[model samples]
Target: MRFKEWDDYIDCLLRQVKFRPDHDDIRAEYEEHLEDLYGELVSCGVPEDEAAKDAVRSMGDPVEAGKLLNSVHNAFLGWLERLLRWAMALLIVLSVIPLLSVALAGGESLIGMAGGYRDTQEHGALVYSVPVGESVALDNHTISFDEVRLYEDGVFELRYRDRLHLFDRAVKWSYDLGFSEVRDGNGNTAKGGSGSGGGSFLSRHQQYFEGFSPDIRKLVIERRGSEYAYKGRDFRIEIDLSGAKEAAGL
Candidate 1:
């Protein structure tokens, strides 16, 4: 190879060395060194081919040099990766602090709110009330009453100590869209067995409430324009009152 040919090859090799940190300056210096070597070879009467081979031999392997350069490049990349991870960790902690504070300030203790019911019932002009504690073992289930009357057709409220349950099953099922036709004892629709369905879930739910009465520990009744309070479990719904005549009948 002539001096010009060898210079062209070195230029191409330098262009391919992407990982070289100071490629331009190093390539220029290498070119000058090759020029000096070519002058020496020409003065010594050495052929161009032999001088080119000698220059290439003196320069160590390009592949090994490239590997070392790549190692340096990857080390920089690794440092950048560690810096990014630490920054991300700091950002995540900063984001979670406000959420934790909000949760604590809400006073929404799961264990504290889980124990009894303050129930209210109203029938026409009468209102019956009770306070029942949850069973010893905490069961997080909502049991509802199908025919629970609020003033017979008025206002009802449900309360729970450890969990929520249903006081008015009719409204609950209605809201839940659990409507089904009223079925008779023979598993057929009632009244001439026409089977024409009505959008009332209570007709089917009554069966589940049968023989399943909770012990009413205390009772408060507002009936016939008067209020009556009772202690202990009692199935008897007494109707004694002294007020407006309508309350008397209530």
Candidate 2:
């Protein structure tokens, strides 16, 4: 719509703008320019209303002008604006993907977080035993590798009676240790999951892992060369699972 006054003309030109720290400055500059135009037209014997109309009309389409002004004031310009917007959007997508993945993984992630809920649920009941019955020394600490379960796929558990607070952090995942690894009979490393280590000073420290290679003759658990070295030795154990299927009667 055409505007008849300077205030109306400036408002029309900036109606679509939502962002601007410079809106007042821009409006004042436009008002001064239009006032000069109106004065020149009146001096030439033009009517007041006609002069105002002519001045506002000469500024072009209000909507388009507003768009131009918004673009000029927005921080990023042209292709740089487009690129940065896309990059920020992509970062949000990448971030949400993990949370979505965990959510989509059913209640397993939640159970994992509740830290031993698997042992209480029906799925945990399906967790049959594959005996490891081995131990390794770290400082004065003796970490005993215990049972394994084939149904849960690479899950293993261990406890240390001699020392609590085994690692710097009370609980840590297998990936936290450079030395800790789950290897199948063929010597290929198996996928490891969240394992934890934390307990009271007087209490035994228990930790579990979610990782197992199916139908393997035996699996080796070792954490020898990692940064969490124990008296210059790497912690290691072996689970003879050649008869795991028969043992669990699966």
Using lDDT as the measure, the top candidate is 2
Mark the regions of model 2 whose C-alpha exceeds 4 Å error after superposition. 1-127, 152-162, 165-180, 195-198, 202-212, 226-231
Residue 234 deviation, candidate 2, in Å?
Answer: 2.6
Q: Candidate 1 lDDT, tens digit per residue, 30-64?
A: 67777778668768998877887676656666556
Query: In angstroms, how far off is 226's CA in candidate 1?
Result: 40
What are the per-residue Cα lDDT tens digits for candidate 2 across 35-141? 88888988999998899888888888888988888877774454566678899999999989876764554344334334432342323444456655666655434
Model 1 regions lying over 4 Å from their true place? 1-76, 102-109, 119-155, 158-250
